[model samples]
Target: MAGGNFMGRVVSYVVNELLVNTLANSPAFQRFAVRTSKRIEDASNLAARKRQELQEQLNDSLRKFEDMSQKKH
Candidate 1:
């Protein structure tokens, strides 16, 4: 009984590995990978744009503050 159980476990492992390998090579998985990559790229671009906008706003505020201080002197 113990030997049979060991053999069954080996077969199961082999079958699972084969299935994983097959799925990885399939067209559907490739398409999914492409779509995920595109989404990440888009999110990164949007974050960069927002960061730049915030920096510009901060610089403008600092300039206004400096101008106000000069006027007091």
Candidate 2:
């Protein structure tokens, strides 16, 4: 029947895609991708911490300058 053929093609397509995806995400591929992602996350966190430290330093300097200006006046 036409319905049976349609169902068979659909099932075939689904199984093929699943197999291809599984191969693509095998252990070696997964390990490299996961490691790369973790490195990127670590880099981002380091940059964020550095930015916060810089901002704190700037704010402290501004406060000291403001106090010095008030003393002069």
Candidate 3:
């Protein structure tokens, strides 16, 4: 049983090494990684802007409500 477990680990290690080397050596993979990273950054920025806009709108609405309430009293 111990021997079988050792052999399984050895196979897994070799496969992992091969995959790592292939990805490191491939230009296409490098470009894909860069593009994906850029897209994630862009999406993050867009979300932040949208969040700010929503917060501003909410603040404006609250101010208007407070002004109307004060005028009534």
Candidate 4:
């Protein structure tokens, strides 16, 4: 059982190394990685902008409500 476990680990390591080398050497994989990274970055930036816009809008609404309350008082 110990020998079987050792062999399984060795096989897994070799298969992982082979896959890493193949993907590292492949031009198509490199291009896909770059495009995917750029898309993720763009999405992150857009979400940040949207979050800021929403915060600003909420602040404006709060200010208007405060102004209206002051007028009633």
Best by TM-score: 4
Q: Which run of 10 residues does model 2 get worst, by summed lDDT? A: 23-32
lDDT of each: 0.98, 0.96, 1.00, 1.00
Give the runs in model 2 whose Cα sits over 4 Å from its true position.
1-23
Per-residue lDDT tens digits for candidate 3, residues 18-69, read 9999999999999999999999999999999999999999999999999999
What residue pairs clash in candidate 1, if any at all? none
lDDT by residue for model 1 (1-73), tens: 9999999999999999999999899999889989999999999999999999999999999999999999999
Counting clashing residue pairs in each candidate, in order, gives 0, 0, 0, 0
Ordered from best to worst lDDT, the candidate numbers read 4, 3, 1, 2
Candidate 3 segments exceeding 4 Å error: none
TM-score of 2: 0.64
| lDDT accuracy of residue 16 in candidate 4 | 100
Candidates' TM-scores? 0.68, 0.64, 0.87, 0.96
Give the poorly placed runs of model 4, Cα more than 4 Å off: none
Could you arrange the candidates by TM-score from highest to lowest? 4, 3, 1, 2
Reference-based lDDT, residue 21, model 2: 100
| Per-residue lDDT of 11 in model 4 | 100
Name the TM-score of candidate 3: 0.87
Query: Which 10 consecutive positions of candidate 1 have the poorest summed lDDT?
Result: 21-30
Native-to-model Cα distance after best TM-score fit, residue 41 in candidate 1, in Å: 0.4
